[model samples]
Target chain A: MYTTMSSSTTTTTSPSKPQFRNKLVSSLNDIFVFVGGAILALLLLWSFCSFVSPNSTITFNISSPTRPKPTKLVEPTNSETTPPMNCAQNELAHDPPDHTFYDDPTLTYTIDQKPIKNWDQKRQHWLAHHPSLAQPDRILLITGSQPGPCKSPVGDHLLLRFFKNKVDYCRIHGHDIFYNNALLHPKMTTFWAKLPAVRSAMVAHPEAEWIWWVDSDAAFTDMDFKLPLSRYANHNLIVHGWPNMVYEERSWVSLNAGVFLIRNSQWAMEFIHAWAGMGPQTPNYSQWSKTQKATLPDKLYPEADDQSGLIYLLLEENQKWADKIYLEHEFYFEGYWKEIVGSLRNVSDKYLEMERRSTAGGRG
Target chain B: MYTTMSSSTTTTTSPSKPQFRNKLVSSLNDIFVFVGGAILALLLLWSFCSFVSPNSTITFNISSPTRPKPTKLVEPTNSETTPPMNCAQNELAHDPPDHTFYDDPTLTYTIDQKPIKNWDQKRQHWLAHHPSLAQPDRILLITGSQPGPCKSPVGDHLLLRFFKNKVDYCRIHGHDIFYNNALLHPKMTTFWAKLPAVRSAMVAHPEAEWIWWVDSDAAFTDMDFKLPLSRYANHNLIVHGWPNMVYEERSWVSLNAGVFLIRNSQWAMEFIHAWAGMGPQTPNYSQWSKTQKATLPDKLYPEADDQSGLIYLLLEENQKWADKIYLEHEFYFEGYWKEIVGSLRNVSDKYLEMERRSTAGGRG
Candidate 1:
């Protein structure tokens, strides 16, 4: 009786076990489907959010404003059949009539048809093809001025002759010259005129590599003197400086602005503009006065002027500006008017003596 | 016979006078022709020289480099028969696949076919067509950091939290934040770090109109305060200052750089670049030291930090920078760290009390 009861119980339990197993499998399948579907939905949502993110939206909006219309849309054909349009060709067709053409059509045809060529023509072709082989051109512009109101003590004709002599000297040395009778502004006289004159020359002669300003009072003592461009290739401005004055006196006039050379680049332009702001016309004029009083006690002149302004920049403002400025001590730039006159007389007497000697030798 | 001889002599004399007059006239004509030809030749030569002058040569050479090949030269056809190729249409046809189109073909067709008027759509179209109608967008960037190796007594996490809190406050007021942990360099820990961080932030986020750098030690006391962009529209940089400090002290630390705002314009970029050159790593570092020692005797710190650099710029550099910088003394930026800690507890207690009161009222 016990064996029969156990077998019946086993049979019922076996059926229940199979049913429970099937239910568990179905539940697992449902869970897997639900989780996969939920994940897919979340992924779609995340992608949509990313698509509309602020940065993406801004980019899209900006691009949309500039997007072209759809009317002229043309699908790109096979590259082999329809080669890309040459940009050079298109540009040539649309170019203005003012364009200068250097290419010789006959030469091109000859090169394609024949292998033989003259050495000269080959050299010419090479030169034409490689135009950038030449060194960068350097232009030196020498500028100066005589104040309109104050006639030079040496007389107007003598001053004019002096400037003309300078001009002739610059011309012989392959440098250009521009001499003005009036200041940039009537108010800017004496030392204040230097900044504007330099800036104006820079604007007027953009092709010039360097703009040099020499004061009317200054005379070229060394006719053989040539500003070696190679030496100043790395420098922006070159000014005469006495190291002794710089170290000991720390005088505003240590670096003379009576004669200076400035590179005609954007940096120099900006520097000149900054320097000009310290002039009497600017709002910082009072500040310049105070700075002069504080730093440069020897500057007796009430007007701060460009010299004091530059000294302020070198000593106090920014050392970067100071770095770009080359202090040249190799040449004497300044002499008193009286001393210069006496020297001029001695030079003329020497020239006269040389002329007389040459004539006597020719006569003999 | 005497009468015949007299007549013969008279005839000879008459012919000789005529011959002499003819010769003189011919010679004069020859001279006129020679002078005229010489003048014409000189004029032509001058014109040729002018054409080949340095300025003209430079212009020609510069233009020649960019001149396209003459292969696809096409004469513009009559406008009536062959319509002009629109630039926009050509651009659309050749546009890459990455381009996004915003033009709705249907909307354009509808607008053309049916002149139905909708004011809102019209206004939107006008707004879309005229984009310059919108006000210039302004973005504020707040940044700061403590260098590595200088572990704050207040934990790094706490300092980060403090910065994060400020960032949250700025976000609520419609601003962004960028916090750096490491110094730009190990040597840039003290004052040199400020310039590099500001400059890097400016470059990283070009979208920001203004970048405000608050020092690590500073905290935002006023949570609700919003920067008045309109007020600072004309200024490039804004700093905290006392009028008396600027005038009397003239000290490098007179104008605290704890909090400052800088514009993201080209001028500001250049200014920052110039400012960074005064850093200890730069060649001008020693010069900066000398300037500080000479100018600001009261500055006890040996390091020529950004603050001293800026003060040097304001007092001694170009005044244009001073004009752009606005000094504010309305609010406090830095207090003693201990005082700030004490104030934080008071603020927390006030907030807690408010929360308790609100919860009690809700329960009642």
Candidate 2:
């Protein structure tokens, strides 16, 4: 319309002889009628073609009250197609129609119990059904304290800040977090409680690749830092450890089980089964403690701890599990608050200086 | 193939004279050939029809490694048609292509400042683009504590449990949560801090209808009970109140301001502006305190509190904001820990008894 109006204006603005202009006007009117009819015919043909072609029929619409947006229906199980708009309003509420491992009535999500088999295949099936949440390095932080109130009056307060810190870190990193105070197994007390919680979380959040167990006592001092998941691509479990220190000190609690990233896999499940065998729930608990104590005697504490059990596993079954277990020695995962608090200022100043340099360079 | 095999088996089983059977078989073969030719032609026609009809071609497939699950490309912004599979692995990473209020140069998410107009329309557009998160009653629990450690030795630990309790409730209810200790606006201290935090949450989560402010000091005693959001459909803001108590006792803190449910609407934005206008940041802060003290003559304390200011607002601006503000007298939003704790065991026991009755009834 704009082009036609501009063309008409151009013809009118240009100077012309009166008789010639009159003749030209009549000719132009006849041509206009003919062109208009032709254009109308072309539009009709285009409309007919569009009616037959479903893909080509979706025209650009903005605030057109006459039409709701174009939509396509999707079967719940088929990740092959997503719901056009509201299909996955229940996105997190997705349970693919085609049965995965959940269909097997025999399958249990319990810890230190029956082991899960063919998890990789089952996980693939799950991923195929829920591609929206199938990122390989997605983490789910699991942390919790005892069910009862803190013995120390100020204990609960400290816990709140620590939990808050974890929540902050998880939110910033787009990771899911679970804080449970329930004791899943009565016998699996203290550190052994992690097993049932981790197992349950694994079954609950198939979308997450790693069930990150950040101990309730620990805190995320540097909120800006994110877990470098890609660095442990080959490994399924990662824990902060100094093996040389373990050898030198000959201490039971060498590796800080306080914070660790364990992959949601069949191997991890098996490792958990082996590790939890040392807990009070098992028949060999006393024997395992004796074995561990004989290896590395400690004067202050004597009961077989979860951390100590893991150390025993690494030392005893080095050939079997060490290949998939990553000892994160380069960075400290957890430390004393007094030790970590002082360096925070330096870290903050360094970050600020880097920011200034980047800003200056950008201005230039 | 199964059908054909069954037909051959039937032919073999049926008794007949050898010579007559042979002639019958030849005759049957001729008839079969003619019918088969017709079927083959029909199959060809059907395949051609399926090729044209896009929707008809998706056949049931199980464990077919030969074909990667069916997939289609998606233009991210167009919720009209979602990507077939991997298109929304970045579902949480959604940013529709259309320009929203966020695109406006002068817009700010800061509290008690520039007001957002046409928020209903803006939220509508956002919901349209993100139908997946467009639940009308979806909640975003906003709670926090002081940035510094609690002065009491066990203060931090108590805060952690309260936060965890909130987390547990939010998780079970399928609601998102945000915990921020950062002072967004410098002068908004103590109770005044909620306004900034609420405003920030409203901007951050356009998906949620209600920015539920549950104070860090409060915890959900009833885990089974969900906020009956449908009950507050007509109201934009809901806070627990005892109007009769306020009238009779004439205390400064008549109603508990520890917990409230405020809807994410333009009305809320305006309410925040009006409410924060009486904060420490404003020149009338002292005057407002004096006004509140005059209204609620309390002997214990005289300083203006957020709860007292709220009471003053209710008394002074009864006609203006009262209609949208629901004073929930039917149930308590918050209460003292000691007051709430005594009834918890009875509540749990009743629930257990009800469950037992239901199970027995089901078996019968």
Candidate 3:
């Protein structure tokens, strides 16, 4: 997501004296508090704009909502090629279909890919696969549960609309079912509290290939999420969020977990286990409030959570995976709400038109 | 988790030409690659030493084998003095007796209190009425499915042994489980390949709390693990292993997710939902080969899984639950593991003695 907001104003404070170091530490805390407050202010402003002047424009160029459609739907050339194995088939014939596979199951999913043209297909595909999620792929969508003004039927509507029509089977108690009782539970901030729900959701839907999460406020924007969906379905992680193209500073990149994906594969599961497991090296609460100023402007600066704990974890993963885990650019759009919403609404309208055409044309 | 070595060696480079500033806008990708690596390297090394090093030591003056005993059972004398009813009890008591809150069903019930303790006899007494945890808490430990020399079982055993008798209950699942089942798919690094199995395990056990993790080689030697267990059962996070008090330079402390914790609470569930529903923020693949330059460090400096992800997520949670979320201190003697494996056998033996004594003493 691109934006033209000014970076955090950095005014160098000349060192007063050797004794001022202690004073500086105290002052740094104040500064961070101020920064935090400023961030809150910025967020408040953004929220107001999002609510009141939701169509505000900002300077940034996201990808155009242009994409190519599949030339044709080829019949199953051979049983080996299209014989349904575990319901993992291309999206062409399945009554609803898997939204994750794009049009083709073999597409190397990327965030930048633009194959999905409409929300109906996307929602339908997800609904079909929601019930058919692989046993290991059942997911627990932990909601903030604040019951704030923003949370609306749209939240539940999105899930139901997306999952009902598309999904044919789900890993509910190891049984394939189109739908099951929607499980609702209170949200927990602690890893321990969430583990059981996550585990059970995964266990019940072992057939689910990926555990999907959607924030209450987020609405689908069409370009094609299948590419990113497939790609995210492959990463093993407890968490992965969007990283903004704009840099507040070197160490930090803007991040949003609002729309991130996680792989339900064994490694990813263990990564979650490892994260939520015992014997973690806890941060020092007493001294964490203190801060030391960075020396260079180019130093990497993490944004809040990005700074608090991610840096350490990412450092370790870097050692292991090197260049594997990351945030997507195209999938997460923050600024220029007017443009994004415009894109989203335009794509949605196009999708509805295409749906009507397909229905009238029969299953051809 | 303390280390005396500092790997930040000075590197001499030619003075930058003035044009470098002109290219700053364009070179952000390059500059970040370098800066992110160095900072992450420092943080990772520090985190590893603080949490990963079983033999690492901190400078705290706590007794070696005299770990604090679990808080004495708080027996409320007067039932009439009980606090008013609220949902906090249900929220806090999200886990059941099966996994984390391992207790007789008759004993595990909700109570009214400001700050709930894990084993408050008064609360337990009150819990008899609210036998309503049809939804049990469970933990799913996740790890990137990197095929490294780091043996999975070694890591699994480390975790199993640490929380063996301390936690209420737990189970271990590895990447091989998902791979053998043919669900071995990953999107980010090969390390992400392991998530499927963990998710599967979680699906199987919907009624469990706190998935604990430990790196293959990490060790745990302590006076007693009662505090650690209760804390994990309480906060529900990817807790760190241990910290090195003597280490001054390193500030960002985290235990390897190889040994962390997660909650089954609402916040955690929401996080999982968001991850699965939305395609995750993808990493910058353009910097895939940037691992060559020592100065540039790896583009994936902070790997975005397990520890880092948890840290990131929980830090965000901390904003909501600041006082409630906690990270423990690094003790000097029992920090990680030194050469005290067999030496601590007596400690475990003594723990057994204490357990027997407490049981024999019988809720006095």
Question: What CA root-mean-square deviation does each model show from the true structure?
Answer: 46.1, 31.1, 28.3
Error of 3 at B261 (Å): 45
Error of 1 at B18 (Å): 34
As a TM-score, model 1 comes out at: 0.30
Q: Is candidate 2 or candidate 3 better by TM-score?
A: 2
Candidate 1, residues B138-194: lDDT per residue as tens digits?
A: 344444444221122222322332343354344223344555443454344444556
Where does the lowest 10-residue lDDT sum fall in candidate 1 chain B? Answer: B40-49
Q: After superposition, how far is residue B326 of candidate 3 from its true place, in Å?
A: 58
Interface RMSD of each: 37.5, 23.4, 29.6
- Tens digits of lDDT, candidate 3, A1-364: 2221122111111111122211212221111010100111001001110011112122111101011122111222233222222222112222232224333434422211222234234434444564432223333332111111112212222222222111101111111122111112222122122232333333333334444433322332221112223334445542333333222232323333333334434444444443332212224322221221131132232211212233334443446542445654443322222223323334334445544564466323
Poorly placed runs, candidate 3 (over 4 Å):
A1-207, A221-234, A238-253, A273-308, A315-317, A321-324, A332-339, A352-364, B1-364
Best of the two (1, 2) by TM-score: 2
Winner by TM-score: 2
Least well predicted 10-residue stretch by lDDT in candidate 3 chain A: A36-45
The per-candidate count of clashes, in order, stands at 0, 14, 160
Name the top DockQ candidate. 2
Residue A258, candidate 2: C-alpha displacement in angstroms: 1.9
Could you arrange the candidates by TM-score from highest to lowest?
A: 2, 1, 3
